[model samples]
Target: MWLLKKLSPDFKTIADFRKDNRGAIKRVCREFVLLCKKRDLFGGELVGIDGSKFKAVNSKKKNFNEAKLLCDIYSVLFLMI
Candidate 1:
């Protein structure tokens, strides 16, 4: 963290540093994706897709689709009215 702090002299906050380096972050992500593709890290099999259990710390619920999101928002708005 201190080494990263030394590297940036203009930014006062971590958020500021991240905002300034957004392009660099994007470039790094693109390069990482290319590298993964080149190395065939995806293990091309149907079995590979369902073998993970990574979820957010707060929610047992998986990601929401458009309908679920609309329903949730409508319910909240209905309650407020």
Candidate 2:
């Protein structure tokens, strides 16, 4: 609930939302995946080669530009769309 509230003021809390909201969230996620699949936007057939533990929103000094930033930005934008 803290997350939903903090991220969206309109949503006071997750508990304040109905139990059935889970279905809506799941459906939206599925629809996004389907859309990406249709657009052939899924890149990198092989992953998990680096084996480096990194924070998503950490300082840029520790993260790679062409590698980490590009991947992170794309993932975030894809989810938002």
Each candidate's TM vs. the true structure?
A: 0.39, 0.40
lDDT of each: 0.82, 0.77
The residue-by-residue lDDT of candidate 1 on 1-81, one tens digit each, is: 686876755546877878899999999999997899799997766653666787655453756879989999999999999
Q: How many backbone clashes does candidate 1 have?
A: 0
Candidate 2 lDDT over 30-55, as tens digits, reads 99989998999998386556788856
Give the per-residue Cα lDDT of candidate 2 at 61. Answer: 70
Whole-model alpha-carbon lDDT for candidate 2? 0.77
Give the residue spans of candidate 2 off by over 4 A: 1-11, 44-61, 64-81
Error of 1 at 39 (Å): 0.5
TM-score of 1: 0.39
Residue 49 accuracy (lDDT) in model 1: 69
Root-mean-square deviation per candidate:
12.6, 14.0
Summing lDDT over every window of 10 consecutive residues in candidate 1, give the lowest-scoring window: 54-63
Q: Poorest 10 consecutive residues of model 2 by lDDT?
A: 9-18
Residue pairs in collision within model 2: none
